[model samples]
Target: MNNLIIETLSWGKLEVTEEQIYYFSKGIPGFDEETELALIEMAESPFWYLQSIKNEGLSFLLGDPFIFYPSYEFELPDNEAEELQIGSNVVVRCIITLKEQVEQSTINLLAPIVLNPDGNVGKQIVLHRSPYHTKHCLLQEQPAIDGKDGG
Candidate 1:
């Protein structure tokens, strides 16, 4: 198995397998210069870190959007599916912006990181004409029941 050593701001040097490295042909939205990234899974957690192999400081904290928004759903365009050469297996993750108050944290649902694990390729897909936005609260607010006194 081929392994690679990558530098990260948070985790320092990490030894990752070749399979962990994902190639982004068009690069991510803001950081278009970075084409290669490593998807590092956080142990015992639903979150994952998308670390740029070339730039140690460039990384994103990603989370499973469905886990936070149980009702979240979206249709992948045929052209996008074809662009990634996606098969039956595909992984989706959203960038998370953590705040001092955890409840205030937000996730970017407008643009999601879609990966083709089999092909080791990924793309940040921006949803068009969608209800989702860039800053959706990571934690869902609890609904209050009608103010009714139980006799």
Candidate 2:
């Protein structure tokens, strides 16, 4: 329950507190055997690394999808909500896939990793009824202040 030293493949040795650990009872999709995860905040950025304690090499780049898609929304199925025992305070994060160009990165909008900050429980739930796709372009042309794209 105290600060534990975690050996990660990418970040090397890190001293993380109990509050940074997330427990996934059913584990994550594709990596069902991994139940213990830790959130490693990126340096001076909105992105984070979701690392699997079971496998030091297993890690993911995550970000708050809302930062890009303000209107993005989804409903957690009743069963999943009950599984995490989470209410309105749950934190939702999406995975990012970097392309050859950083501007061409994509985000997985179909499945989101939900974390119950209060209980330290989390789950990666696939949204079958979502209107979004798994690979949404992470970077798009920004609309100009004058109402026209500054292309």
Q: Relative to the true structure, how large is the alpha-carbon lDDT of every model?
A: 0.94, 0.88
Residue range 16-71, candidate 2, lDDT tens digits: 88888999888888888989999888888879999887687999999889997888
Question: Candidate 1: lDDT over CA atoms?
Answer: 0.94
Clashes of each: 0, 0
- List runs of model 2 lying over 4 Å from the truth: 142-151
Clashing pairs in 2: none
Please give the distance, in angstroms, between residue 81's alpha carbon in candidate 1 and its true position after superposition: 0.3
**Local lDDT at 70 for model 2:** 84
Give TM-scores for every candidate, taking all chains together and pairing residue i with residue i: 0.92, 0.88
Q: Tens digits of per-residue lDDT for model 1 on 40-130?
A: 9999999999999999999999999889998888999999999999999999999999999888899999999999999999999999999
